[model samples]
Target: MSVKSAAAKLFAKKIYKKTQGWSSNPIASQKNVLNSLIKEAKKTQFGIDHHFDQIKTFEDFAVQVPIRDYEDLKPYVEKVVKGEENILWKGKPLYFAKTSGTTSGAKYIPLTKESMPYHIEAARNAILHYIHETGNADFVDGKMIFLQGSPILEEKHGIKFGRLSGIVAHFVPKYLQKNRMPSWETNCIEDWETKIDAIVEETFEENMTVISGIPSWVQMYFERLQQKGEKTVGEIFKNFNLFIYGGVNYEPYRAKFENLIGRKVDSIELFPASEGFFAYQDSQKEKGMLLLLNAGIFYEFVKSDDFFSDKPRRYTIGEVELGVNYVLIISTNAGLWGYNIGDTVQFTSLKPYRIIVSGRIKHYISAFGEHVIGKEVECALQEAMEGTNARVNEFTVAPQISPLSGLPYHEWFIEFENEPDDQAIFKEALDNAMRKQNMYYDDLIVGNILQKVVITKVVKNGFQDYMKSIGKLGGQNKIPRLSNDRNIVEVLNIK
Candidate 1:
């Protein structure tokens, strides 16, 4: 091993030990985080408004601060944007992570000085945890690439604003800078297509060993690399072994990715968000990412079924149960209190608190009261595609409430990497998987209320074309795995 590799293993061992201290005592760590957040923010305007000074427990904090989204907290965010001090957290925020919003407009999530380090630390610890667990730290000496948003930032009233991934680029540690790929110039290219082309030219010849990005975006990168090099990504980068990802489930893309790479790679699933760095895969053997209880964020969960109910009960870390879907709410040192990040997560393991991103609370299909989530669909697709040449490039599900003939059913728009020899068998396998995963969907089918799932093969790169048409082609933009309405399907021209 190189000096760097030896040093990385040592560092990983140390960090892994530190993380174990908190991971073993998750509930206590969470309570301490909540107390620290409240104590530090008490002097701020938001804290004063919410009576944070008098907050003695999680119950008091929840009662004092109501759940708020970006729009709901826009008034305070506006003040922060206009260079106001101590409006949300202590003093001024270091940066504003500008994320795409709906009709309400763009959202500016604050990254306070006290909270920003946790993002970097969480990402670092994720890798360290992997290295310590697997005893594989040699990849640190090879080229690593992170396909992400442009690191360029725009200034508004003294605060730098940009995509969370972009903002994080500024903090890439000096030690790993040498191993990082796609030079500063390539990363600065604003157009994702152009940047990707440039990245292909820059790094396709390099010794890339670790690659990180959303699976969809990374798939695009792999396609480009294959086009350029005329070889599977695995062949081109023989040492490549680790794939770290977030933003979307990789299960549906697993078959396609393996085909593109021509091999299987160990992957780490991360649960990072603009709101906060929540969790990361700590063990290759585990089913879910280890929730970061000591990440300077206080978490709350409202059972997703009752998320819209009148005053839903907010359960803290200690109260959360295993296997239940709950809408994740957070109060962070970043100055977001009772903030509904809109994600629903299920605890896969409670002994040390590991969770899988179940789905976005808003991004589900309950059109027929089946309430199928992202995890279910992804899991179903994964099971169907396993050990088969049924390679799926991309797919999304939407309710087909109206049809020209027969009962309405769920429409699946799929872009196939490899067309199955027997479409009927593939579809049957997919349907069976879905039926087994979700009882509600199975009941609806059994009741003859809905027909079997209809598969509409999308034109090659059709989803990419659609996203480009809508100006959300790349970066952090993601297609909702499940849509309650036919807005996406209608545009998909499936009729």
Candidate 2:
């Protein structure tokens, strides 16, 4: 190994050793984080208003602060946007991470000085943990291509606003800065298609070892790279080993990604949001990410089934159980109190508190009472594609709700890179897989309550074109895999 590679290995080893204690006692670790946040924010207006001074325990904290979504917390966020101090955090946020909203237009989430480090640290630890687990640190010696948004942040009322990925790019460590690909000018292009083309031109010959981004966008880059070089990604970037991704489930795209790369690389899943960096995959041997118990956020879980019910039961980190879907509720240093980020996750392990993101609470199909989540849909799709030559490029599902149609059924719009020879058999395989996974879906089909799923083969780049038209084609923007309404389906013009 070269001198730089040796140094990287040492750095990774050191980070692994230092951060191992963070998840030692998951319950106690989270409680300590919560206590610190509560004590620090107790002097703020929000803290005072929420009786933070009286919150001596988790139970006290939960009782004093009610669960709230983005809408519920908008008043305080608006104040922050207007340069109000101590409205949410102790002072105005360092920056605002603007999330592209599907139903709620747009949301500006705070990124406080206290909370910013957690985002940076979580990403750093994710790599460290990967190196520790796999004993692979050569990636650090080569370039890393982070498929990020424009780093040129927009200033509004003295607060910067941009995609979280772009904001985080500003904080890439000095050491890694030398090894990071795609110049700042390329990243600042704003348009994803234009930006990706620039990135392809700039990094096509770089010694790329790591690539990080939402799967969809990175996949686009890979496609472009292959087109230009007429070589698989593995042939182009021979040293590429680690792919860190989040924002969407990677399973359904796993086969497609492997085929594009021409080999399997170490994959790490992360649960990073505009709200906070929550978890990171710590072990290759494990299925889920190790929850960051000592991070700036204090987590609460409400059973997904009970989330919409009156007086939903909330569970603290210690109270969470393995295998149950829970809507994640968070109280963070960024001034969010009992905030439901809308994502649902299930604990895969309680020992060190590891979780797999199940789905988004808002992104589900339950039109006929057959509630199907993104995870279930993804799994079903993966199963359907098994023992077949089919490779999915992109897909989305929406409920076909029309009283005139006799019976409601789910409609799937999919773009295939390699089409299945027998389309009817492919559709049947997906239907059978769905029935096997969800009893409600099975009953709906068997009892003739709902018609069989309708599959629509979308034109190439159909979803991409839809997103581009909306001016939200990149950086954290994702096509919701499942929706109760046909908003996306209509936009994509999928019949």
The per-model lDDT (C-alpha) reads: 0.86, 0.84
Identify the runs in model 1 with alpha carbons over 4 angstroms from their true place: 364-495
Q: What's the residue-level lDDT of 176 in candidate 2?
A: 81
User: What's each prediction's TM-score?
Assistant: 0.76, 0.76
Q: After superposition, how far is residue 343 of candidate 1 from its true place, in Å?
A: 0.2
How displaced is residue 118 in candidate 2, in Å?
A: 1.2
Of candidate 2, the 10-residue stretch with the lowest lDDT total is 98-107
Q: How far is candidate 2 from the true structure (C-alpha RMSD, Å)?
A: 13.6
Off by over 4 Å in 2: 102-104, 364-495
- TM-score winner: 1
Candidate 1, residue 20: Cα displacement in angstroms equals: 1.1
Kindly list the per-residue Cα lDDT of model 2 for residues 1-495, writing each as its tens digit.
Answer: 777767767877887776667676777788888999998988888898899889998889878899998889988888999998988889789999976432344678999989999899899889887877777887777889888767888998899988788899899889888888888888778656677789999989999999998775677789899999999999999999889998766765688789999999989998888899999998999889988878888999999999989889989888888899999999898999999988899999977789998867777886554557677788889999999999998899998755465666889999888899898999999999888767557756764546788899888898899989999998999988899678888878543
- Top model number, lDDT: 1
By summed lDDT, the worst window of 10 consecutive residues in model 1 runs over 98-107
- In model 2, what is the error at residue 280, expressed in angstroms? 0.6
Clashing pairs in 2: none
